[model samples]
Target: MTGAAPRLRSPPRNGGVRHSPETARKKSPPPPPSSSAGGIWESAHFLKWTAADALRLPVRHPIPCVLAASLLFFMAVEYTLRMIPATSQPFDLGFAATAALHRGLAASPRLNTLLAGLNTVFVGMQTMYILWTWVIEGRPRSTIAALFMFTCRGILGYATQLPLPQGFLGSGADFPVGNVGFFLFFSGHVAASVIASQDMKRLQRCHLARLFDTLNALQILRLLTTRGHYTIDLAAGLAAGVLFDSIAGEYQISHKLNH
Candidate 1:
């Protein structure tokens, strides 16, 4: 029998390059199967992994666990508590702070008028400061924030109208067209003052900022005393002012970038 010829290996065609076994294994893998069963399996696996990771978070961060527990506790309490009767008003702890003042205002119309006038004056001051920042200082950020805040406040206030608090003292000297008919879920006075004060601080006018802040505090007291706004309204108004201010800053930044 004739001897078999030795087999010879062919050279690589592309620049004699050859991939090592490890490199070949590391190449991009094929896409997953498109079958419904495969898709369902993948989705279920993902959900399981996500749940496991989430469960681990409490162990990794104790503060989050504490917060979650507090949230759950409050939720349970709220659910178990009896609902307020349709004809009754909800109790607010904030009202207790102004209870004495309310009594005084109820008895003394003259003093109530004086406080209302002062509060109105504070509102004017806030308006002037905001406008001055835009027109004189050529800083429109505060104005923009005020506009954003009021617009949002208007929407929220109208969407969920809270009843005017009992024993609310009214005065023709109040802001916004003498408060003939207005939304009470949030206090625009407080929000506008916050905007102005924050802007003053940003401008390095600490004295002016402090002044506005002092006035704001007084205005808040007067509002609460007269029942012009609930405690929640004032708190939400403060948050809204800061939020809108930050949003306005972002808007300004985006506008600059776009231009």
Candidate 2:
């Protein structure tokens, strides 16, 4: 009994289990790293290297840099140029392209008349092709695009009334009745042709699309020569056609999803 007093045991510290000093030291987290000048210099060097790399990229890809330079030049010109008077007609570089043709039209009414007739025929062709895509070919996207474009054109055209150009050649055979008066901010003819051409391309009718593109170029030249539309008008018309076609495709997609 009292021979060997029961061996005594120590209670666990800090919880159920006690760890040795060496184990505790190993389990503890390391101290935070000190912020050193070398680290700051390394970060600065990295940023500088990144910036230099980005700068060199434009050297290899010069088109974007050229465009940026051109933009800056134009901005400088715009800033330095005098404001045009309210009554004066602003000069247009696009008009310069057809300057001779414009003068020719002014001098020869017969030639103007003939060109007008041809333009009318082209208009008819665009109409027929557009309708054919919808009514005959069972593809309605082109027609829908034309409708959307015209609706938007009407709204914008009526909102701001641009005075007719000085030497516009009026034609009885034009799309508008007698070419007496119409919207001058956007060319429906060009927009319609674009719509039809885009539809042809989508349908893999490459030959027809190319034909339409060629005719569109000629139509653009004629419109510019006759002053049927302003340079901005034709440009906007092309953009509008592409925009409306995209809209039509989106609408068709949404409709299908809903169904």
Candidate 3:
């Protein structure tokens, strides 16, 4: 009889055998979290959504309309307040006192011009980010809401302005805009920077966010040293930033719930 065929040893049940291709494919873990800015830029939804796409989307609720009306109303109030004359009613003296510390620099026309130039550059950068992330991302509602808060802050700032009983010694020259003294109750520049920084961070633009945050800090300093705004003004602007962020968050939640 032919020698019995050597019995092939059955594959050991769990002898560290290599998995089949199908099993290996199925068990592969999901991709790792992306940490690079380039990755974020490529994956940004804003890059995909076009303006026409945004327009075609139906309004699921009236919140946006209401927000629009509120924005207009606040703008009207701001303009009205600006038209009113400032008064001699005394308020806090902290801003003037702090500005006194930088009197020499504040009075330097060259320094002032440099700061203005820097401001213009940063403002342009901020606008670009807003258009790219908010407008293109189909989140125009959030943008509008933030603008409403800005208007509200302006209204409050103008309403709060009172003629400094005694002008600050060595304070920088008046801004180009005549009658801006009445608008000195709050610093719109600082507030705007705050809002822009938040927007950048929300979109995962960490570098931009950090840069804007530094700009915001500088703006707060500018407002104080340049005497463009009172301490209360900067404080109010910061508060407005917080308020606007909250409004944007609420809008997002409401929209999510509605959908």
Instruction: State the lDDT of candidate 2 residue by residue for 40-101, as single tens digits.
Output: 77767566667678779787889988898899999999999998798987566678889998
lDDT of 1 by residue, 1-259 (tens): 7999989989986589988888878886977767797677887756666777888888899897999999999999999989889898767667788899889888998888777788878888889989998999898999999999989989999999999988889988777646598888788999998999889888799999999889888888888888888999999988888888999999999999999
* Cα misplacement distance, residue 94 of candidate 1 (Å): 1.6
Q: Please give the lDDT score at residue 151 for candidate 1.
A: 93
Ranking by TM-score: 2, 1, 3
> Over the full model, what C-alpha lDDT does candidate 1 score relative to the true structure?
0.87
lDDT of 2 at 146: 86
Preferred candidate (lDDT higher): 1 or 2: 1
Instruction: Give the top-scoring candidate (lDDT).
Output: 1
Q: What overall lDDT, based on C-alpha atoms, would model 2 receive against the true structure?
A: 0.86
Better of 1 and 3 by lDDT: 1
Tell me the spans in candidate 2 whose CA falls farther than 4 Å from its real position.
1-52, 59-63
| lDDT, each prediction | 0.87, 0.86, 0.66
List ranges where model 1 is wrong by over 4 Å.
Answer: 1-15, 22-73
> Candidate 3, overall lDDT?
0.66
Model 3: weakest 10-residue lDDT segment is 169-178
